[model samples]
Target: MLIELRPGTSAEAAEEVAARAGAHEDVTAWPVRLAGRVFVVVSGDESLAHVPASPAVLARRPTPDGHWLVRRDSGVAPREVTIGPPLSGPPEAPRQVGVVGGPRLWWAAGPCALESTEDAVETALTVRAQGAHALRAGLSKTRSSPYHFPGRGLRGLEALAEIRRAAAIPVITEVCDPREVAAVAEVADCLQVDGRQLDNRPLLAELGAQRRPVLLMRGPRASLDDWLRAAEFVFTRGNSAVVLCAGATGTPQQPGFGAITALRARTELPVIFDPSHSTRSASLVAPAALAASAYGADGLLIESCTKPERLYRPGDAAHMFPPESLADLVATCERVRDSARSLEVSC
Candidate 1:
C-alpha cells in the first residue's frame, strides 16, 4: 500500500496513514493523510501513488458545498471486493444493510409527487420520520402519455437539495437525461436510473463518470443479463458503487415473476426492490417485500404517501400505505431477516 503526504505536511503523518491502511494486511488498503482529514484508496494493485505530484491525483475531494473530483492519469482502480469502507472515513467496513436511518431496516420511501417545493419537503420529512433511511423522489417523471406531466426541471431539483439540507438522511432522485447527470450530481446524494431509461446506455455512462452511488433499476421488459450488462456500463466507467434495483416488470402474472431473485443471483452489486411499483397496490407491497428479502435483496423501496388518493398523480395504484404501513413492513422484514440468519447458522 502507498501513502501520500500533502505539500506542507511532514512525513510523520504519512506513517500514521500507512499504519492505518496496512492495519489489516489480509485486505489491501491505501490511505493518504493531510492535515486532519484522511483519504483512502482501495484498488486491485497494492502499489499506491505516494507523492503529491499534482492536486489532480486525488480521486475525490467532496466538500460540504459540492464535490471536487480531479482528473488524473491513474487513480483508484476497481476491485471485486464484497465490502469496503468509505474513501475518507473510519477504518471499519460498513455493515451490509444500512437501515433507513437507524436499526436494521433498509427501507427508502418513494414519494411520486413534485407538485410544489413545500410538497417535496413535507413528503421527505414524512418518510424520514417513519424510520426511512433515504427519500426517493423523481426529478424526471416517466409518465404514461405524451401529454402527461413531466418534472419541474432544474427548479424541482432545488427542492430535493433543500430536503437534504433540512434532514439528516440522504435524498435520492432520478436522472433520465444524460445531460442532467452533471446537474443532478450537484444536489442529490444518490442518483437513480429509471426503469424506462435503462436502455439509454449513454446516460448510464454519463452517470458513471460522475462517480457517485447509482441505483440502476431493471426495465420492465429488460432481461436479467441485459440489466447486469447495463451495470457494467457504469463499472467500466470507474464507478464501483453501483446497486441493482428490481422495479416492476411487464409480465402477465399479477405479482409478476420473481425478477428480484434472478437479479440478485446474477449480480454481486447490492440489490434493492421497489415493492410499491412491483405490485402497484398497498396490499401487495408486503408480499413483494417479503419475497425480495427471502431472495437476499439488500433493501426495500416502498412508495409512502400521506394520502395516496389526494395526490395529483396518474400512478395512484403504486402509491400505498401511509406512515403506519411503513412500520408494519419494517417489523415483518425484521422477522424474515432473523429467520434467514437462523437458517444460515443451522446449515
Candidate 2:
C-alpha cells in the first residue's frame, strides 16, 4: 500500500504516519517532490483508513506494480498525474541487450525502405561488414502523400524476413496499423511505431499486447511529457521491451539532439537516435550521428543503401548514404562510442 501525504506535510508528520501504519522503516516515506507528494510504503495488509484523518492526509492508493498515480489539487479538473518511480536517477543496464553494467552502443543501419529481398540482403551484408549490429527498414511506411510509395506491404515484409535469415542479422520494420501488428511481429525482431501513430490507441494497445520489443519514435511536435506518456501507455500494458528512437518524426523542424538529453534525464529507457531523418541530408548524417554518440545515445538508426541516388518510395533523397560511406560513418561512430565509454569509466 502507498499513502500520499498532503501538500506541505512536514518530514516529522510523514514519519509519524509511517510509524502508525507499521511501514517498514527502510522502505517508508519515499519523497517524490516532483509529483508534489510523499509516498509511504506500508504492509499490504495495512489499512490506511485506520490512521487518524487529518489535513496531512491527501490520498491513499494501492501501489500497482510498484507504481502509483496520485492526484494534484490545482485545477478545476484533475490533470493527469505523472508520478512514478524515479527512472532518471542513474544509468542502468538495459534489459533488451542483456548486458551487465557498461556502456553498450547498438548500431542499426540499412535502407530507409525495403525495396526487394536482394536489396535488403545486400545492404544488410554491407552494414554488417561495417560493424552494424541490426538491420532496419520500413516495410510499411506512414507517408504524407498516399501515392508516395506507401511501401510494398506484405511482399516487403517477406523480403525483410528473407534479409534477416540470409544476412544473419536482426530485422526491424515499422507497423502502421493495428491489424498488421501480429504479422509484423512474426517477421521482425523488433517492431517500430512511427511518430504519426503515437496517439493511435488501438495500434499502441496491439503492440503492447504482442509483447515484442518496440522502437518508439517521438512525434515531431510532441513535447517531452507527451513522449513519456506515450511510453507509459505501453509500460502499463506489460510491455517493457521498449527502445526510444528520437528524431525519427516526419516534421521538418527537427527537435534537435537536445531532446535526447531531456529524454535521458527523464527516463532510463535505452535511447537510439535517427540522424538520417533528423537532418534529412546525406552529408549531415555523419556529424549528427557523431553528435548523438557524444550526447550519450545508446545507439543510432542510420539509413544506408547500396546506391543512394536510386532510392525507393518513402526514402528521403538527401538522407540515404551509400554502403562505402556507411562504413566510414560506422567507424567514426565507433570511435566516438569508445571515447564516451572511456569518459564514463573515468567519472
**Candidate 2: segments with Cα more than 4 A from true spot:** 1-102, 248-252, 337-347
Give the alpha carbon lDDT tens digit for every residue of 48-167 in model 1.
323344432333332221111111112321212121123221223122223221225477785764555565566667777777767777788777777766776567876676766665
> Per-residue lDDT tens digits of candidate 2, residues 1-347?
55667878898887777676654443333323323446554544443324546567777766443323211121111121111112211122111222101255676788777876776788888887776767788888888887887777777766776777677666778888889888877777677888878888788768867656778788888776666656655644445557778884435576368776676545666677899888888888888999888777777888888866666564565788666777677667768868875787432
Any residue pairs clashing in model 1, and if so which? Answer: 100-133
Index of the highest-lDDT prediction: 2
Worst 10 residues of 1 by lDDT: 65-74
TM-score for all models, in order of appearance:
0.68, 0.69
Which residue pairs does candidate 2 place in steric collision? Answer: none
The lDDT per prediction is: 0.60, 0.66
Worst 10 residues of 2 by lDDT: 76-85
